[model samples]
Target chain A: MCQLLGMNCATPTDITFSFRGFSQRAGITSDHSDGFGIAFFEDKACRLFVDNQSAVESPIAELVRNYPIKSRNVIAHIRKATQGKITLENSHPFVRELWGRQWIFAHNGDLHDFHPRLSGRFTPVGNTDSELSFCYLLDKLVEKFGYHEPALNDIFTALKEISPQIAEHGTFNFCLSNGQALFSYATTKLHWIVREYPFQHASLIDLDVEVDFSEVTTPEDRVAVITTEPLTHNEVWQAYQAGEMILFQHGRPIKQAMTVVERLQREAKDPSLKRVTKADQY
Target chain B: MCQLLGMNCATPTDITFSFRGFSQRAGITSDHSDGFGIAFFEDKACRLFVDNQSAVESPIAELVRNYPIKSRNVIAHIRKATQGKITLENSHPFVRELWGRQWIFAHNGDLHDFHPRLSGRFTPVGNTDSELSFCYLLDKLVEKFGYHEPALNDIFTALKEISPQIAEHGTFNFCLSNGQALFSYATTKLHWIVREYPFQHASLIDLDVEVDFSEVTTPEDRVAVITTEPLTHNEVWQAYQAGEMILFQHGRPIKQAMTVVERLQREAKDPSLKRVTKADQY
Candidate 1:
């Protein structure tokens, strides 16, 4: 299993604070420490930093923690090397350009035997199942709508329709963004929180660090943070129900859809595969 | 025009020393200032950093100058934006994955009225002639050799043949690499230097910096540095010919080819465009 962190905000917000806590999972707090990667979007352009080294000690990860590269949409991952070798190419938070917009993606859970036929349009450079899924999704998007890019809602609709097929293979929790909006899907574990006006102090669960958000943010600023687990202990983080997909924009969850996890549970080819339960609900 | 810099070496080497001097051209030493970018390859994986801000003042550039990220091949660019807006998407040192390998490219010259028919296998993320050229080259390479990546010599042959077709539009000096070999094509300006066992002292032309290579390198270390102009004033740099393509491997020029600049000169479709000359040789 890997860990994912995503942020979408109304204004450009520095993720250094959240990243510092989330990155601790790479080695210090927990052990998902095969590799780490992060993508910061400035408008349609993205500055992606990926290293095969552990995030706790990687110089690039240190740079990311210290430098405040503000972005409306950001995705990060700390890998545990479930499916690929620990190489720079295998690190998560993969990037590709579609519709003249750079799309970034990061995955958190493993997809067992999930190999979809790629259209050779958006091929994976690395041999990771995560990257393969991303490529397959992109190819499907391109296939559904030719040359020109469709609306975001249409894309979400297409993604909603196709995500279950991949999810059926195994746990498929992922965060994807095109800088305009962030789309997150979960068949297993995922949590989210929105920090807006009247933001309060929060303490990191992994580190003995606390931050008073009021001191650093304007009243108009709003931030949506999604992660495998809640980074802060005090904040009321909302856990995604199994087989739920949510679209986050302007620091809030605006839309959601349900998958066929229940239907698949009723008609299970493998009884042990459907691991959803009441605990998965928010 | 933009300024291009590339490094290919026998061993992994940090480029902070060269980058410090080269980045100075973004604002302080010379003005190619619109944006800047650099791409470093670690095996088949790449770490690409681009900024719309001038390298002299960009914090990311400062980080690059301070951090010792080592690589065997690197491509850097400082833009004097002639074709596109000064945006991150339009920054040079564009990257794309081809044949499971990340291909990096940076250009120093322009291509006028040059829009080739894209096969949709590869597309430009940004609106730059440099990026278009990179895409067209990749698409053509894929078309010529489907699925499998070809040999370095075959790639050089294909590049040697395809380069002139793009160059016919305008000046098209560029550097491209796939972590295996560095391929450089020159129509107007490009210079290269190789530092080996018997290294000597060299001083940057743009900065008051000097380094004795013998103290920092081993007998086995070999490095080939290519730029739009010689980065160091004291080193004997070899300039690329008017229409020449060189494939550099293991820090040395291993193969070379000549383009039809002379033929274009003989049959000038536009009298104003034929700028090929004996002065181009060094």
Candidate 2:
């Protein structure tokens, strides 16, 4: 198992506040600490920092906690290796280039016997199931759309169609981003919260730190934070139903779909649900 | 023009000593201070750190100077930004994945009107003549070898075959690596030095720091350093020919070839110079 943290914002923002408490899970609060990695996207480019060391101890993670690298999209992971050796390559979040843009992916759950055919378009340098799955997902994207980049909606559609089939192997919870948007899916556990205007003070669930959002943020700023577990105690965090996928842009969910039980239930009520989903919002 | 630094070692060695002096070129010693980046390879994986901030002022660069990250293959760059904006995306050394391996590259020279046909297999995330040329080179490799990874010698041959054509646009000095070996080519300026058994005291040219290598390294340790300019004043650094390419592995040059002037010079005596070169070693 692993831990994931993702942030999408209407404006560029830093993860120092949330990352402080979340990184504590690596060694202080709980133990998922095999290694840790984080990626911050600035437009089509990304600044990625990864370490095979525990997040609590890695000097790179220390920089992440102190440096206020503001970006509209961010994805982070603290890994407890389930499938690969404890090496730098095995650490998530994994990054790849696609459609002339940098794409970042991180996983939070373990998959069993999940080896898909890789067509060599996208390949994994690390011998981890997480990286393999990420490569498979990207391969599917290229296979569907060819070399030209598809629209965000079309990408969301392709992911929605592919997430369940991969999830069939085992627990498949992940967070993915391409600077413009964040797409998240969960089969077992995941949570999210949106912070906007009129925000109140929020206290960390894992540490004795608190932040008054009103003092630090503008009214125009909106941010969506998704994690494996809720990082704050005061804010209301929404849990994702199993097999649900959410695409976040500009700090809100713009499109969502579920591939398992929820889809079947929605299809029973509306036969026209073949291409649409009830998971439009939380 | 920018500054480039690279190290290839028979054993895992830290670049802190070299980086401490090299980083000074970003602001203190010279004015190539637009931005900077460094990449350290651990097997097939690389830990990359980049900042749009000057290496002398960037906190990330400070960490790199202080942290002793050990690697056999390392590449670093300090940018003057003649080609692209001083953004994180444009900072070199740039990285891309091919044949399940991460390739790291950095250029110290500029190119003019160097846009080549891209077959969409690899693309540049940042708009720099250096990155564009790297993509063009990778596209050539994939075009020649398809999805399969060719042998290092074959890759070296492909690069030798293509280097002069790209150099036709402008200066094309660069250092590239794929963990297993490092490939370096230069049209204008580049230098290298190999230190082994009888290591001596070396003093920095940019900073007042001296290290007695014999005290810090074992006899088994051999290191080859490549840079735009020599970092040490006491060490004997060999300058690359006007158009020369060298492949480094195990801290030594195993293969070398010249593309333009040197090739013609050698060919004046022997027509057999078509497939062979006098640049077999430094």
Candidate 3:
């Protein structure tokens, strides 16, 4: 399993504050310190950094804590080795090119004998199930939509249909981005929140620090954050229902759907192994 | 640094499939495998699993891949050893008790020289900065709201104000939940999306698997996922702006705000250390 952190906003901003608290978990306050990586979205491009060292000890992590790189969206991760070796290539918040844009991904769970067939549309740079899953998703997308990018709504609908089939094999909870909008889904646990006007003071749960958002942000600016757990003790965090999938644009959720848990459970009891696969039309 | 995976939906769903693909990156695919942990929200309470072994090799992870534990929300993490020693106490998706409810958290990034005075109202169970940050946050919430939980909106407002203060110390991105809604913030990188009707096939970038979501969900179901990267290769993921904060309810963004990066950058240029701390206050 792994930890996830994400940010989405209406305007460009820096994630130094949140990253400060989040990085601590990698080595200091909590033990996620396997490897760490982060991606910052700036318009159509993104700035990405990843290290195979524990975030607490990584020089890059230190730089991130001290430096304030601004962007409209950001994603960060601390690895807890599940399948792959602890190396730079294995570090997450994995990035790829899709539809002429950068697509980033990070995963937090495991799969069982999940080998699937693929075309040349998308390929995994790393050997992780996460990367493989990412490639498979892209391959399916291209196969269905071809070269032209589809409307976000259509994409979201397609994801809703596809996610469960993947989940059927194992725990599949993840966060994804393409410099435009964010997509997240879960089979076990995921949480998120949006922050806007009338901001007040917030304090970190790992460090004895605080901030007043009202002093820095405009009323018009909005931000959305998603993570495996709440970073602050004072904020309101929302939990995703089982079998749920969501799409976010401009720091807000625009679409959503549920996975097929009940059906899977029933099948699990039958012992027939008659499972839902990609062969079944969605 | 660590990786995080999350899911939120209108109905219960199992994360096995996505976790199977994502976990491959832990040790077999990417190498985050210092440790792994996952939490599943079953109604109000959550079922959590943490392993000091690589998720790819852990029997628990294997069970996760084979068994579909249905839940509305899920959070998972893979460690790479940054802060605390590689032990269970250091694993992420950290949980705490607040307002008579369980609060869970996981982070990605690092903090610098971020020791703060605590009031003992919220004490750290671990030495990681992430957990300390969680305790500190709870302490502040207790200071401001006393015993009774405030409205989610009010809490969001308070968090917005305080997050920047904490960010001043270093990066402070995280996700928080209390069995109700999810709250997330980023000072660096984070992304999210929602999935709903009109499902289609999607592929994974890390593996060779694909799924068709349309086969599993209904028109009424909605889901939101937040992560450090996009899990699928083909889908368009939304990115979070720097210094942004967000509140999510029912898988939708209800409040958002962007942090001021320009000011922070200017302050970063200050030569004196004392001035640097003061600049963080601004």
Candidate 4:
């Protein structure tokens, strides 16, 4: 399985320290060295970089480690080939234009036998199931809400209604951004934490490194980090519940929800659930 | 680049709703379909899955979208090839044994000429810098503290000292876990957020999905999410400062630090910094 790294903060900050430890797993301490990529959000757009090299050995990775480019939102990943071939075209943290803003996405987990028909609005650039689903999702959103962006609450309600149909296929967990807020969801595993004033020292599990946050950030700066696992040795990291969804903005979660297990179980017993797919029109 | 999905809460909650939306990018909406993987932490260990396919097309990803596996800590990623060929050997959320516990890691960004000498304490199973770095980090930690695990704070301090040296070689941003807390850092870009009581509805940028968190979570449940970018449409996401480090435990940022730009500038000015490499070691 691949690993994920993300950050959301009230102020622009770099992730050199945590990234140093996290990158070690790409080839040094663990597997997951297929390829790596990252995106840095600068307002409504992002600076993205990807490499079909391990984080430990890739020349580009070295530049990231040494250079400190600050941003308010970031997403990154290291590949462990699951579906597509190990090529630059199939990197994670995919970027797209939506509502006049650049949206970024990354995913973990797999879906089996999920081939959905799509219109021309959004399409996959690669042959990964993850991208296909992303396109289908955007298509549905535009179809439902049109050009004008809807209120977050309204969109959330629609998402809850549509998610179960997709979940029937397999494990699905992901992170997404539009240079504004972050959205996250999980079916199997995902974790996160928020950092604010009175920051202390943190150490990495993968690397023999530590940093004192209090010395770097201002009292007004707040940050939230979401990853597939805990990145620090001395900090509190929270876990996501099964089938929960969350939204974050201004370094804080603004929305969240849990799947209805009973409903899902009922659907499992019904043939109607099996018919849900991208083929079904919204 | 890869994508990350994470969730953290005061209490165990399901992430199906969010996962459904986020997973779509793996292949359906975005292009991270090289391979997909996820890890769910129950207590100390994790349930992990990886597929060399897009989450949108993979039945496994679909199942993830529907399944409601509950956990407090979780990590997920979608790969885009960079170094190693797309194969199971290169899958992420790489796990290793440390102090009789499993450690997980995922990374984004590339490294340049980051070849460190290994002492055999940890070795690379894949041909990517990510794994090599992981092993090197563990080796360093073990070398510094021996078999017994040191205090998280001490580990953080050590990591701080070691990260810059490694980062000097290339870009380094990553997420790591030792079954205790989630650690994250970035040299370029990363963002994060926290969610607590009174969660509201959230919409996803990649999918037509939304959820009303207030409907499922309790007021006591606090969650922190860190990512490469913000994941929601309405919530505020904070960005990391240039060369910042942080640690997360219990869904909160307990520690953080900023990179010493002055020191880095001095290092850049000194030709000696260029001579620092594995060849110069020992």
Decide which is better by TM-score, 2 or 4: 2
Question: What does TM-score give for chain A of every model?
Answer: 0.92, 0.93, 0.91, 0.91
Per-candidate DockQ vs. reference? 0.54, 0.80, 0.01, 0.01
Native-referenced DockQ of model 3: 0.01
The lDDT per prediction is: 0.88, 0.91, 0.74, 0.71
RMSD per model, one decimal: 4.2, 4.0, 27.6, 26.0
Instruction: Please give, for residues A1-282, the per-residue lDDT of candidate 1 as tens digits.
Output: 999999999999999889999999999989988999999988887889898899998888998899888899999999999888998899989988787788999987777767788767777878888999999999899999987879989999999878887876778899999989999999889999999999899999989999999999999999999999999989999999888899999999998887665446554777766554332321
Candidate 3 is scored at a TM of: 0.48
Compared with the true structure, what per-residue lDDT tens digits does model 3 show for residues B48-80?
566667888876577567767776778787777
Off by over 4 Å in 2: A262-282, B262-282
* Candidate 3 local Cα displacement, residue A185, angstroms: 0.7
Name the candidate, 1 or 2, with the larger DockQ value. Answer: 2
Cα misplacement distance, residue A12 of candidate 1 (Å):
1.3
Per-residue lDDT of model 2, residues B140-191, tens digit only:
9998999999999999999998887787777889999999999999988999
Score chain B of candidate 1 by TM-score.
Answer: 0.92
> What overall lDDT, based on C-alpha atoms, would model 3 receive against the true structure?
0.74
Predicted structure with the largest lDDT when compared to the true one: 2
